[model samples]
Target: MMLSSMTLSRKYVILGIAVAGLIGSLTSAGAQIQYQTGQNVAPVYEGWMHNDDGSIDMVFGYLNRNWEEVLSVPIGPENNVQPGGPDRGQPTIFVPRRFTQPPGERREQCVFRVRVPAGWGPKQEIAWTLTAHGRTDKAVGTLDPLDEIDTHVIAENRAFTITEGNKPPSIQSLKADPDTVTLPGTVTLTARVTDDGLPKPPAPQPGSGNAGGRGNAAAASSAVAALAFMGDASLDCR
Candidate 1:
């Protein structure tokens, strides 16, 4: 009886130690799996930028706090415009992050409107929300009437016709539709106009930098994509 009691005590001690060790291992494994989460910052509206066509652009910037790619930062469905519903306004934007910008730093001018509709008046506001990684950010901008002066005036006033960044825009695919119209009437014209100063779009051009334009809504996305290509240094901006 004494020997049996002693054996039972030894078995209990061994089982307790094994159970403790397993708990410790699990705790250590959990520590290894856990990590820090990053913040997805909202875009900053840079205000209305003027275009030569008597229209203005809504310039914006953003920051992705994570070091990795924050894919598909989309505008939320609840986001909308007043008096005309969402369709009367711009569509939701898709802003993704790449290595072009340093992690956690604001990517300035990441996106911009080629042109905002005219007659928006001096103080119109649009609220937009972008969501990514289960995080949401909202930004609002006043479509302030463009307070702009002629660039030619500034350059000419100083007798500086050409500056370091001065670039002459190209008129690509310029055409007058209905080559044979009714005698001396108006014919529909179509063309792509791009400014050569900024980053080129992802699409390759024969031999050029970025292209810029504020065309019909149908062509807006394509134009924006081409403009993005200009940022590629491999394309040789020229």
Candidate 2:
């Protein structure tokens, strides 16, 4: 009986050590540099209607690994639709602005907001998705993971499709009238930039549909505005 009790004691000691080690490993894993989605703008279709009589207000949100709210910011607003229309109700919140995790910090949640136009169709919402990019130092995760969380918002019957990936701004149009440059006088240069505007695009595969998708429309317009400025400058030089 004495020998059996001694063996039992020894076994319990070994078990305790194993359990403690396992717990330590789990703790370390939990701390292993996880990331939360940062808030950002969702893509908008060209010529699509928006709130505030075609204008939009975008807000963003951020979270930590334990699924806790971290930070939020307003990324700015865009007047995607024309100004004259019946009040499309109050502006909807789309793509709540948020912050990315700083190095060495864990993230919990990322939220986004967009103002939806009243009476917008379901298809319009279907094509829309909230695409967010992790900071350069962080890796992108799968859509399945993101869908599990309440990360996106659609107001007034507007829906959205969420995706993830990396993206850089693309120059949609660039022109220098009189393509050649001469040494003597200044030549106006026109540049148009189109970007998904995300640090990255979701599912960045080859021939992806609308590399920038609906977001490209807004970017294209901005590029055009920039090009117009260049045109003015070029004529001024002449």
Candidate 3:
């Protein structure tokens, strides 16, 4: 009986030690996984703005505590005004710029804008923020913030000048229509415009007029146009 009792005690002791070791191993593994995953586990935000002229603009940047402009690009402007050129009718606006973070820094700020529709009100302004982590491969101590905005309002009204043969007309809105009409008088007709924020089809000439560089700039414009008018189904900007 004495021997049996001693054997039972030893067995219990061995089981206890094994269980403790297993628990310790699991705890260590969890710590390692957490360490491997860098900071900031959040989703980035993106903003989309749509204009009545069948054009769309997209502005994207990071935000920390407040709104920051990271990058802004206007898409359909190039194709409508330029006459077979990428940016002929499009306004010559500054492209959104990016900033580089120095070592040990974990946050950044950026800002951008979209042209308001003809009758947008002050209350139409919309803003939002999001968080994301493990975006960078370097395993920085902190993560970055993603800002997003999607707003709709009346298009802005602007004056356009008509040259000798040019017509004085304006873009009202974009819709699906399949009809054609001929006017009685010899009036100049301005073509209706629609854009999805994608790059306009490549202009016939690369650098002839408003068409910018041949690479990403052209492609990005078209992309933005496509995203804007396509109804926010694919893009989360809205």
Candidate 4:
């Protein structure tokens, strides 16, 4: 579907903000190189949001420079948010570049957020620093008017419809039996999802040239079946 001009502009604005937040330098040669492993991760400051309760959330994400490696660094000096603490609810699991995205939209964006009080000053800052592959980089958050983000920004970034009553499906619970296993072992997974049953399937008319008695429902079901699992869930044995 074609994106509205407003949506496209907002998306570009967020991207510009992300680029401006990078705080350290890296070798220009590294940008041309794609490695399967042994690459650094850069924390990204996506933007900030104004909450209804007068609090603001500083959104953040990451870019794992590697093309294939997935690193798990526990919260500490290596992965930290400063001024308030070493842990600001940031992620420990860093996955490789999102190759699935279209060319310009690949870097992971808006993965998590750190909330700041409404009284937070415009000059105040929150810094998320990450050290990986023998290098360090940071993303700083502030109350810059140009760096504010909202639901429309997110909808545009995710390429999802933002109708008044439209809501995305929620995964209530997802669990894997045993949560871990040795090599050559099978793990059972269960997920419970809840939805509003939106965009109900089109009704079939007597002779509209539609195949199958279910009309569009069959096609919808097929599409859902094909997309039953929406993310990459891989176990790394290292």
Give per-model TM-scores.
Answer: 0.40, 0.24, 0.21, 0.63
How displaced is residue 166 in candidate 4, in Å?
A: 1.9
Provide the overall lDDT of each model, using Cα atoms, as 2-decimal numbers: 0.50, 0.36, 0.33, 0.74
* Between candidates 2 and 3, the lDDT winner: 2
lDDT by residue for model 3 over 1-238, one digit each (tens)?
9999999999999999999999999999976652323243221223445566844443433322112322222344311211133332222222122133333333322233334344444334332222233132111111112322333111110111222343322444334233453544232223344343322345454444555654333333311222112112122222
TM-score of 2: 0.24
Candidate with best TM-score: 4
Q: Who wins the lDDT comparison?
A: 4
Q: Give candidate 3's total backbone clashes.
A: 37
Which lDDT value does model 1 have at 102? 41
Q: Which is the better candidate, 1 or 3, if ranked by TM-score?
A: 1
Residue 193 shift from truth in candidate 2, angstroms: 25
TM-score rank order: 4, 1, 2, 3
Count of clashes in candidate 2: 35
lDDT of 4 at 115: 87
Q: Candidate 3: misplaced stretches above 4 Å? A: 34-238
- lDDT assessment of candidate 3: 0.33
lDDT of 4 by residue, 1-238 (tens): 3578889999999988777665323445556676889978888888999999999999998878888887777789988897787988888788765644446564677878898887999999999988998898999999999998998787778665466675766765478897998867766667665677655645654555656444333343311211111133543221
Estimate, for each residue in 146-219, the C-alpha lDDT of model 1 and write its tens digit: 43324454344324334556665676756766776684565654666676543233343343443864333322
Error of 3 at 45 (Å): 17
